[model samples]
Target: MSDSILFNVIPYAAALVTLAGGIARLTAKEPAAPPSPWTPAGRTVLAGASIVLFLHLVGLAAPRAMQVFNASPARLFTLESLGLIGALLLSWGLLTLGLRRAREGQWGAAVAFALVLSQVLTGVYVAVALRWASAWYLHVTVPYLRSLMSFQPDATLLQAAPLVIQVHVLASIALLGAAPFLRFGRVPARTPASVEPGLLATPREETP
Candidate 1:
């Protein structure tokens, strides 16, 4: 396969693995006092998500590099935007896992999850907004500003598209991060509360 195809496929596979593992854990029978922080299910999802997230970062950075090397503006914008969306979603998934762990009283694990999640969310927004601004700088705003350089422009209108994009990206990331945690972390401990005599009683045969 081509390098480009491999690059895209890797992240997708990682995401699928993470999602599958997470779903499995959610459906599995709850253990008393929550599963170990390093349980098989937890580790699988965490590792998968981390791999996917790293791939996403690489994907986002590539477009910026292409732009620096004089790649087509349209293609740059499209690639960057898609990368931003992917990164946002990955970060969101991570944060959600952290929140869920916290709710289950796994504070340390939750904190670690949250730290990475928050960083990814913040970075994705900032990077996407900057990328959008760069697009406007090369496309519309810079040209307009140059035209008005001689005349005193009454008011300046900067592109709000980038800011809006940033907000939406951040929101999306946060939501995705919160989803799994909310779904799985809320599961109560699966302790055997009480043993009833009836449950243990053997069936008795009736005599005529």
Candidate 2:
């Protein structure tokens, strides 16, 4: 079906972005910079954000774990509660971080935070609007993931999903692709190099 084809292609496109971004990071250099001053509040916010990111990924890993654990309704409900908590943490963490960055004149950082908030809000909406989506997600996504891992993606499982869910999937793919380039998981900054006036000149230009 066309829907399934789109799902399959979108992941690869997102992957391309991630791969390209990573390669660009690896080959690029940065200017020398002094170490940033860290404060207790900054550390707390960072730790919270890290935890929220991990909590978001937990759902992806949970299905296998749950299968092994023989997941029940009670356990599923607990997971649902945990998802809500993660969403709350994400919302709070992002809002505070965005405000702090904006106050410090870091408009770019503030904007990035706002962009991330959209994703978090989408997830929160799903958690609320789509009843038992977490449980259903396992049945749909886990298999699709397993298939992809084996180099054979089967998007048919999710073809019948609502439009919002499809959009969510695409957004997740974009996030995965972009995360490598973003501050959350970016590579170390390389030392900057000075370029001479004729550094890039050809043989004719080097004559003087």
Best by lDDT: 2
The CA root-mean-square deviation of candidate 1, after full C-alpha superposition on the true structure, stands at: 16.2
Candidate 2 TM-score versus the reference: 0.70
Best-performing candidate as measured by TM-score: 2
Q: Compute the lDDT of residue 189 as modeled in candidate 2.
A: 41
- In candidate 1, which residue pairs clash? 92-173, 92-176, 92-177, 93-177, 96-177, 96-178
TM-score of each: 0.40, 0.70
Q: Candidate 1 residues 83-135, lDDT tens each?
A: 56655566666666676788779786676666556655654655554555345
Question: Can you write out model 2's per-residue Cα lDDT over 1-208, one digit (the tens) per residue?
Answer: 5665667766777778888888888788966456656544456556656755564466566767755443687777776776677676767777777777778777777777777777777777777899665765677766776676677888876767776766666677778787766653122345688788887978675564
